[model samples]
Target: MEQITFSQLKKNLKKDTTGFKEIKLAVLGNCATQLLSHALRGYAYELKIALNVFDADYDQLEPQTLDPNSELFTFEPNYILIQLCSEKFQLEFCDLSPEEQESFADRVMARIQEYWRRVEARTKAPILQFDFIEIDDGVFGNFGLKTQKSFLYQIRKLNMLFSEAASKDKQVFPIALNSLSAQVGRDTFFDPQLFYIAKMPIQVDFLPQIAKRVFDTVEALVGHFRKCAVLDLDNTLWGGVVGDDGMEGIRIGELKDGKIYSDLQRYFKALRNRGILLAVCSKNEYDAAIRPFREHPEMVLREDDFVMFVANWEDKASNIRRIRETLNIGMDSIVFIDDNPFERNAVRSQIADLTVPELPPEPEKYLDFLRKSNLFETVSVSGEDAKRTQQYREEAQRTESAATFASYDEYLQSLEMVAEAKPFDSFHFARIAQLTQRSNQFNLRTIRYTESDIKSISEDDHFITLYFTLKDKFGDHGLISVVVLEKRDNGTLFINEFLMSCRVLKRGMEEFIINKIVNTAKENGFTLVEGEYIKTQKNAMVANLYTQHGFTDRGNGIFHADPNTYIFTPNFIQEN
Candidate 1:
């Protein structure tokens, strides 16, 4: 594969920019940025995202970032990428004494912190700051690693300072250009000719890579990350078919060329540890496929690692559909990996939204393919994510048990469910923000909030925020529901946003939540409680939610109910 050249990207800038997710980006830098903007838009289009870039003037990042009346503030971008030109620091570093270098670095750090605070106060957009690439003063050589007096030492110290500060900020995320440059050698990453001629520090060949990093970060912020890894058996898991080769003949474990399969299994297990759900979709006899997982001594993934194992001779597309149904997740949230091109093409043709990466013919390159492709980019992590595999495994058991019950209502009653509701705390703030960003089908209002926005709501006195956790005879479904109520001046409590996880649907939890809202309104001495159902392409299932729950439609997406006239009854869910 060849690198995308500057001439090609410039020629393709005016192509159609429709039919993709529109992302607004503001680029403020101390160098020329026109070419970078074109490259970013070009690469983003390939990833099914359309970028609208707002590039500031050359070397005016300070004025643009700090001034209230600047166009940067007016653009209201979803992200602000601040690229600090290395030239701005090179001259100062060459002249300062060892004591003066400390004071100078401190001043730079202070200025950066002040700039971040000013921008954050004005807008809710996240800040992405670029870390510095190495610049050698040529006098100290290897001694720069030990002495703070060296310019390279001071620059490294500044990078450390930036990272420490960003670690604590929920809204600030640093782009590690130092590490990126190291990966792609600095000689190839920077072009001195372009820097002197056009004031562009980054090379043309490196544009696509940097642009991908930027787009991946944006994709994560808007909740486009893949959640599940669907696997294939036979040649994919082992060397040959289990039905034909048998347990002793098939190549896995200690056999020749079998270590690659073991390495792949360890890789998948690592993904499972980081909250990616694993499942098997194979075409073999159920018992034959179960032999390796149950009896094989060298198997890295046990029967419990996978939430669902669909081992039959069904078509690959049909098995994938059943997996989607059982998991209760959107089709776009799956990443299907198969060793056979026929199976991969079949799934791709049937399901246009699913991501199916083409695997190499050899088994050794499987890990390399996964490492290079940023298919599972994420920006945040929580305790709930770590326990996701166990949670889904419990759900599978619950599904199997439901078959024994005569009716759906009988099954719901037998679970002995208990829901614990609480206000927003530090532990659950990240997960709540994540839910709001990702929950589309069941979300009312469809308003996306960042962690900082949620924190502000918790601190504000006019809003009441609560999250619900559900536990049944099966197991704990962590933090499944969120509700935000705003206190209005006319003694009406307005539901700002309400959403729930789709896994817990059709279980009478909705009725219990509405009853809880009504009771809270009565306790607060409010006259009327109102709710809304804004229509979106994905949220049509929730359009008539308020109407079904006994709220009169006041027109224009508004529904209101008088708290005194509302009659509430106990349901299957017991509130704690």
Candidate 2:
């Protein structure tokens, strides 16, 4: 792949906008960031995400953050990239004694915590903080790991502190600058001449790579990250076809050719643990395809690991569609990996939105390419993520049960549905933020919020934030719906955001929540409730949500409902 040159990026920035989905991104750093803005915009165009880059004044992060009326807040950025210069950051603490360095690191973390607290309190946008660059000490070369006071050791410790801070604070996302530097070779990535002349620490050549990393995070933040990875079985997952070669003939164990396949299975299993749905879409007999997983002792993945195992003599495109429908996700959310070029092209032709990566002819390059490609980037993960496979399996079971029932309503009722509505708390914060970032189709108003934003709303007296969790006879659907009601006045309430997971659609969940809204309004002194539905290309399914839920359409997608006139009953959903 040809890297985007700085000159090319500058030239591309002059082109007219293609009008992709717009995202406000602010870049703030001690190092020169003008080049990064152009490079990010150039790369983001490929992802169909229009990057509206706001280049903050060089080294003005403190002033921009401390001043409430600063341009950083005024710009209303969706993501703020804070790149910490290695020289500026490491020079202060590198010369200190071991004990002093520990104290200094704590103080630095405290300062960062304060900065985050102030910024988070002011804005809802999440901060993308870049960790310190790796700078080795000349004097303490080999002993740097043992010497805590050395520049190399202190910088490493600082990175750890940054990671810890980010883990605790949901709004702070740490970017591994050192890791990127290591990947591209430190000597090539750092430009000392440019650093002295233009105050640009990252080389002009590396700016594009840096920009790509930032955009990948932005992509994940806006919910473009893929959720499912569909794998082929025959030559893709193993050495040979199980049906033709038999279970004994298939290469999948500790042998030379089979070891790489086992390694690939391990990689997919790890992805499954991270909540990416693993699936099998193969052209073979079901029994033959599954026998390896069931009987092969060296196989790293078991039959239970995959959420959907589609083993049949069917077109790859159709099988992929079945996987998508079974998983209840968009076609774009599924990634199909196959060794056969014909199958890949066929699937790509049928599902235009599907991500069919061009596999390397060699299996050794598979894991590295997939990892570096950043197809499954994620901003956050919750406990519910680990249970994704089981959740989908339960959804599949529900689908099967729906077929057995005579009517849809009968199937819904027979499941004995229940919903628990509550305000956002520590336990529910992560999931609520995930839904805000992930939900697209059933989302009304199309507003995205970070965990800090949800926290602020939950604590504010004027906002009524509610998260609803659905449960049926099959299993529990954890924290699937979020409704944020802003009290405009004593007499009226405005729906600031109303988003629900698409998995709970057509289950009377909407009606159940509407009833809760009415009951809550009556309990309080509010007499009128209004809602606004902002149309996005993906959210057309919910364009008529407000009108359907008893809200009067007042021109231009605005809706108003009088609480007294609203009639709702919790007939199907048992409120908990």
The number of the candidate with the highest lDDT is 1
Predictions in order: lDDT:
0.84, 0.84
| TM-score, every prediction | 0.92, 0.93
- Where's the lowest-lDDT run of ten residues in candidate 1? 1-10
Count of steric clashes across candidates, in order? 0, 0
User: What TM-score would you give candidate 2 relative to the actual structure?
Assistant: 0.93
Question: In candidate 2, what are the lDDT values of residues 1-576, reduced to their tens digit?
Answer: 345677777766766767777889989987788877778887777667778989997988789889989999999998888887878766666566668875665677787788788788787688998887778756587897877667677677778888988998878888767887887777888878988898887888877777777876777777777899999998888888799999888888766699878888888999999888999999999999999899988889999899999999989888888888867788878889999989988888889999998988888788777777667888878998988888888888898889989888788889899899998898878889888988888998878787777887899999998999999999998889999999986688888889998888889999888788877887887899988889887999888987887788999888988888787744588988
**Cα lDDT for residue 138, candidate 1:** 64
Clashing pairs in 1: none
Q: Output the number of the TM-score-best candidate.
A: 2
Model 1 TM-score relative to the real fold: 0.92
Judged by whole-model lDDT over C-alpha atoms, candidate 2 comes out at 0.84
Give candidates' CA RMSD values in order. 2.8, 2.5
